[model samples]
Target chain A: MSEFFQQIINGLSLGSIYALIALGYTMVYGILKLINFAHGEVFMLGAYSGYFLASALGVERYSASGQSFPLGLALVVLLGAMALSALLGVTIEALAYRPVRSAPRLTPLITAIGASLFLQNAAVLLFTPNPRPYPPILREVRFTLGGVIVTNIKLAIFVVAIVLMIGLHQFVQRTWTGRAMRAVSMNMDAARLMGIDVNATIRATFAIGSALAAAGGILFGLDQITINPLMGVLTGLKAFVAAVLGGIGNIPGAVVGGLLIGLAEQLTAGYLSPDYRDAITFLILVVILVLKPEGLLGVVRQEKV
Target chain B: MTLVGRRWFCIAGAALLASFSACKKPGGGAAPGGSGSVTTNESSGLIVGHYASLTGNTAHFGQDTDKAVRMAVDDANASGGVLGKPVKLTTLDDRGDTAEAASAVTRLIDVEHVNALIGEVASSLSLAGGRIAQRRGIPMISPSSTNPKVTQVGDYIFRVCFIDPFQGKVMATFARNTLKLDEVAILKDVKNDYSIGLADTFKASFTALGGKIALEQSYSAGDTDFSAQVTAIKATKAQALYVPGYYSEVGAIARTARRLGLKVPLLGGDGWDAPELFSIGGDALNGSYYSNHFAPDGASPKGKAFMAAFKQKYGTEPTGLGMLGYDAAALLFDAVKRAGKLDGAAIRDALAQTKGFEGVAGTITMDKDRNPEKAAAILKIVDGKAKYEATVGP
Candidate 1:
């Protein structure tokens, strides 16, 4: 019915944001073989950066009339956040991950958690623990498609998310750096033997993944209309689950997982009780883990003793 | 160090520390209540301890209360201190957590040796702190915790603001009488006691008033998505939506509801009063209504003077929570003056007998339950700002 169709639209938009953030987790895990728990904090930082950039540009002052959609200003702020988040991502990798790379696997994992907590507290200390309302960048305009109300912001989020995914896909398939990334992910020692600079490749992967997450953060702020220091915690966890469900470290699987998780969450909330939304998302993860072990698109690999 | 020697040393050390703490407790208690032998020099000034969420999710509530409390203390000291001695206020940050609130109260009672306590804007936090103050027999007053269970903690606990049941009825009445909306949908935060209590009361009152509830949905606190709930409510084609949750989520809900083309005006409770409401809800909340403790935009002479004084001190408009803080402190100060002593039992008796205490929020008279019987104000969001509408009384 119309209500069903309406939920689908909501699911897709929500799924797109999850997908954008999932790509970051998948790419970093693909290259580093490490779950970057701090990636969520990176997403939070991106939202804050975008918030500051928009404020610096006087987006609020100009949009006070509520009639103007400052798309250009929004884009500028988004791109600025992307760039800053990339830098932060690279810096975190260098300081936190690189130092503990040779240590036990648990060491780096703990470091990632530590880094996440540190960044969250630092944001709290800097910004004060109040939630800031994200500036209205797009005017509130709605259009109906067969009884389903779709806003312009929702359409823009879907379009931008798809575009970014396509751009990332093409970059990975067609570029030399992308090939180097795939090479490192396959066999870091072998890639080094093949004259590939593994460290640079890893940094590049982090940068690109972080840029994608930043885009997700900005879009989420726009969609939800509020951003806080702790906003990234639950969201980051969900996207990580999405990546796992899609088969962690598999590019296409992350997209599929993100969309499926989004759809499942929205459908569950719409049809059932909202209290079960988070429970259902994790339940899917458990079912997938129990049944397949490997993700939907994940490939089984043989270990040589 | 041999094993036996180390064991004896540990036992001896623990005993020494225990005795020291035991001695300190009676010493601290004796100075205030004249019940023990130990004497202290710092008992000359009447100390009032306050704990609130000054640095966490609900920091705005605590920060506003802290400002208003400070203004009240300054005014009290300028006129004449309580018990003819300077009244000192000590505020601790509870970070909006129950465990932290309990610990904060413990510190105030045991360490600071405060004669009285004020605090904990959130009901859950107040419940935690109130239990501690009740055990210690310290008179504690909450500025804006509206849950009835707050005062039910103990006879020593009190609140200046009206409870959630009254607030819920006020909003329900406004919806049925003022807006004349017959069918409504309620989206409540199931994880929060305040929201659940308010929603229940509103639903009961609305149904009793011959108004039908078209739909009812629930969400947990801190949830960012209300799409499913909004869609469900829209499908019901209700005349209005009642969201009994805090401003953080309500603003997002309002935006989501409007985006889905549900044009009926949203109704809410005092939790919707916050500066962030405008920023998040924007023009989408233009015509929504909410019942509040006191509308800062009202034209009462007492309210106007309080607003002017608060603005002069804080350089911002006083929020409803801030006004409640000022009123609670003023009420407590009046009780202290009436008690004519720094004794907690005496102060509790005075607070119980409080009648017609003129506060900036309203004239308050404490019932047997220690809840202030006062009028609730209804405010409408017009052009992205809250305008005072009407005051509904019990």
Candidate 2:
């Protein structure tokens, strides 16, 4: 059915953003052995940074005046936002996570939650909780494929998400930093014994993960056209569910999990009842947890000792 | 490691304490209930309490309502204050949290010893704060919270705005008559009492008026994305979409609906009356229309004066919620003046007997149910502005 195709497109578009956000949670867990709860705030900061940077570069002014912003400028803003978000992610690592790193596993997790609440409130204090128009990067252009309608923003989100996922895959599989990350994930002390700077590796993982989340945030802003301080809370939790569903430490699993959650949410909203969208998403999680406690892609590894 | 954790915990504790102390509480100077300053037995000053969501999700409603109430206080003071006693308003921030709203009202009643209460531009919050006012035998007036059950707390609580059924029927009637739309889709919010109630009433009235609901959908309160709901609506051949949700999600919904090529204009209720609606919804919401208490395009002379004064002070156009706030506060003052004293029972009696009071929103008369029998405004969004289309009177 056309509605079925439309729902799939909707699901995939939403899922791509979820995938991007989930990748951050997955990588950080992989590297630090701690779920970075503040990663969602980092994504939120990414959206803000992009908005501020675009305004700084007169792109927002152009959009406000009903003029179309250049695509090249949009890309530049996206990269700039990602870079700023990376620096913020690194700062969060140093200030919030690092101090609590060696204390206990639970300590960093608690600190991450604290940092998340702090950042969420700080955003409200700074941005004033007013949902601002995410300055348009592209004029809304719609294309109907058969009976299903697709917007340029939706297509762009899907394309960029897939491209970024592939690039991350290649980078992780081929790069020396990836090897260092893997070594660190294998055993922190063992990685340090093997002359790998575990801290730097963890920071790099955070930076990459944060950059991915930034991309997600910008795309999400472009599609929604509304950005607010508290937008990250529910979204961050959903992405975390995606990461856990796909095996928290598994990269490809995060993307698949994101897509599945997105599809489940949309399909449920489209065909079933809209109210049950979240219920279904969580139900799938519970079912997945019950069946495969280790996650879809997660391996049951022996203790490193 | 334990020492390090303890040291970090101490630092975190110090930081938390520093922030709490450094943060200024909004209109919060009074001590606890049992404190020495608990009773305001002196009749020289009339203290009225107001609790509002001054800093959270619905802060716009709270802040705007507070502005109008403050202006009303100034007006009353200039015209020989309520019963010759200088009226002082003690406002407390609920932070848009229901628990905070209850505690704030508790503090106002027990600690400040206010004569009356005015506040909480949200229905759920007014419910939280109103229960305390009702139990404590204080008269409370909610500016814009329109849920029928808000006043059902007790006889002591009242609302200036038309209730949810009236708003829903007004929109349904306007849709059938003014817009000439036969089939409309309904997207309700399951978690919100206001949205769900309005949607149900609208559905009932629309069907009664020979209009069919082509589709029905529901979502939660704070959902940022409505792509799924909108896509589902797009599958239907509905002429219009009725979304009686708040502006925060409505704006995004409109954008998503428009982006997905759903050309039918969205219809909404009072929850769509925020400045952010224009900015976030933009050109996508141009053809949409919404129902409200006040529309600036066609205002009464009194309404025009209030609008001008409000614009002069706040530097922005006053929404219907602000107008409702002004009316609520002025009505309270008038009731107190008629009562000839700051006594709660006397003021409540006067408020119950209020009739033909000329308010900026409308000529309001308190009905038997402690609600103002008033007209609702239908405003169509045209080129980034809400233009008055028509008004449906009770």
Number of residue pairs clashing in candidate 2, backbone atoms closer than 3 angstroms, sequence gap of 3 or more or interchain = 0
Chain B only, TM-score of each candidate: 0.89, 0.93
Instruction: Quote the positional error of residue A168 for candidate 2 in Å.
Output: 1.5
Each prediction's Cα lDDT score? 0.87, 0.87
User: lDDT per residue, candidate 2, A1-305, as tens digits?
Assistant: 88789889989999999999999999998888888999889989999999898888898678757889988888999999999999999988987888778897999999899889888977876788777788877677899999899988889999999999999999888999999998898888989999998889888998999999999999989887788888888788899899989998999999999999999999988889987887887888788899997688998778646
Q: How many steric clashes between backbone atoms does each model show? A: 0, 0
Tens digit of lDDT per residue, candidate 1, span A1-305? 89999999999999999999999999999887899999999999998998898889887677865457477877888899999999999988987898778789899899899789878877876777678888766665789999999988889889999999999999998999999999998888999999999899999999999999999988898888788999889899999999999999998889999999999999999998888999998999899999986799999867557
Candidate 2 off by > 4 Å: B1-41
Write out the backbone clash pairs for model 1.
none
CA RMSD of all predictions: 6.9, 2.8
- Model 1, residue A36: C-alpha shift (Å): 0.5
lDDT by residue (tens digit), candidate 1, B161-250: 999999999998988888888999999999888999999999999999989999999998778888988998899968999998888888
Give a tens-digit lDDT track for model 2, residues B236-345: 88999999998878888988888777899999999999987877787889889999998997899999999999999889988899999999999999898888878889
Winner by TM-score: 2
